[model samples]
Target: MEEGKPISNIDDELRQILAEFMVEVIKLEELVEVGRKFLVRFQQALEFLRRPSIYESSDLVKSIAKANETKRVNAYVQAGCLNAYDSTLSVGQLNTSLSDLHDCVTKSKSIIDELKNLMDKAGNALCMTSDDQLETEIQASEAIGSEKLDGVGCASYMAVIYSMVKQDYVMQEKIVSSLSFKSSSGELESYCLMWSLRPFINDDIIRQALKQVR
Candidate 1:
């Protein structure tokens, strides 16, 4: 009976750890969705700032375009239509968008930290169980399908996702920070495209993560 008690305890610990891991996976999925929304908002702001009228009306844009006579003709002609173009609205929108993006970055950082902690805990738990036992327990837990993960596979999967998300957020921060009155229409277009494409994030991994939650 005494020897069996250790086995029972290990089983209980495994079950509890797997349960907690699944909950964290769900949280990660939700956090990723929030990031997606932030990206959409950022893209919209970029699009608005990129409009020909808004872009050409900026005093800074005019100054830069002046150095290139070819661009100056188009920019000045557009600026002429709105002789009293006030940049206050554009500036305000830019400030608000940047502030919101900063908030998103903070939240993303928090989520990533939590994921790291969870991964560590999972790693420690992995030490208590053998490969075969861990695989069996993971399959029994049914949080993620047998084909999806075995042993520390889920933890590694989440780590990969967290890494990608962290990189994506960093990229977004750079793009948003770089935007200014001096940004050319072409630069703005590229920024918007990059945000939408999210080259750092993989759709397959995202799908796999989503399946874990369900």
Candidate 2:
């Protein structure tokens, strides 16, 4: 970041990139809201379709179990993305981010594992459904929502996973890897992370966050 230079400096590029990233963050917030709703409703749907008299003999329960896993994996990926992105900025310049990305990932995994439990519960209830209800809820919902032609919960979870993890976390990893640094080891992974977050985070300040966390 030299003074009176016609070319763009790192600070300038960082501001530009951050502005772009915020647009996606806006989308993430909305998707998270939608995800929160779907989790609740999907659970309710399973509870209703689980009545012993209704689900006594059916394969519909199986689908619910699968959907639960689908959703859990999606949320888990999102959590990973958040951890990765935050880590990029959290670590110090010329130093690895203060918080260990793997540690944060481990903590996040615990929360996401709950989705697995919900799925198991739904599966047990589905087995009891009679043929008619199975036809209605499991096979019949094909025409229920706007996605009449596509696979159901799978796509929803897929989209969520792509948004939270790949779009931000995995993608950012590539950018960090691409960045070139001066006179430093991979410790400069910290500098690369800070580059993406330059707009709101002063270099010195981010340096401290990385140090504090470390």
Candidate 3:
């Protein structure tokens, strides 16, 4: 996660998954379509998991007990909002289902965070490209230095670059296949980093980063 950023955005791995859908200049409609599909799929999966998560018990209790114990001791533990877990558990108070709901809500919230991040990226892509005065505003707001370009402008450029890549059928399929559970989070982080760079870095630099990842 970015410093001071509370939610998990797309990590590199998920960005790579997104790259397959990108082109040098992706249409806004296409971006929205892809995002909608992902959102729907995530919602479906969450729904599928929700029932078992609320109705089932044995395993969830053990996990939550261990997790809470870990959180209690480790001040630095990176975790989701306690309120999400707390509210779900509070409703079921005396029941084991409380733990189950906690686990389910936690996971679902993370997925929702990703969806929010995706929408941000899509919005960034549009704002950076369509707005004429955005650069001036950004330039005026920040000190005139290297860091000036490292904000939304940079992320916008990265989004454009990903869209520009001429898709290779075989390579794209392979890239998608490589994203197993073990590497998914990392890929998401990578995608986020690549696209989240300062806009001044230019296309060649972003392309090189993509090449190395490939």
Evaluated at residue 88, the lDDT of candidate 2 is: 42
- State TM-scores per candidate: 0.57, 0.24, 0.20
Arrange candidates, best TM-score first. 1, 2, 3
Q: What ordering of candidates by lDDT runs from best to worst?
A: 1, 3, 2
Q: Which pairs of residues clash in candidate 1, taking residues 3 or more apart in a chain or in different chains?
A: none
* Best-fitting candidate, scored by TM-score: 1
For each of the candidates, the C-alpha root-mean-square deviation to the true structure, in angstroms, is 8.5, 30.2, 20.0
Candidate 1: worst-modelled 10 consecutive residues by lDDT: 129-138
Model 1 gets an lDDT of 0.58
Count of residue pairs whose backbone atoms collide, per candidate: 0, 8, 20
Task: Tell me the tens digit of each residue's lDDT in model 1 across 1-88.
Answer: 2343464454445345545655654565565556556545545555555555634458876675666667646655566533324444
Q: What is the alpha-carbon lDDT of model 3 when measured against the actual structure?
A: 0.38
Alpha carbon lDDT of residue 116, candidate 2? 31
Candidate 2's displacement at residue 181, Å, is 52
lDDT of 2 by residue, 71-160 (tens): 655554444313344334333321332123323333333333433333323223233223233223333332333432122222222223
For model 2, the run of ten residues with the poorest summed lDDT: 149-158
Q: Relative to the unseen true structure, what is the C-alpha lDDT of residue 140 in candidate 1, on a scale of 0 to 100?
A: 41
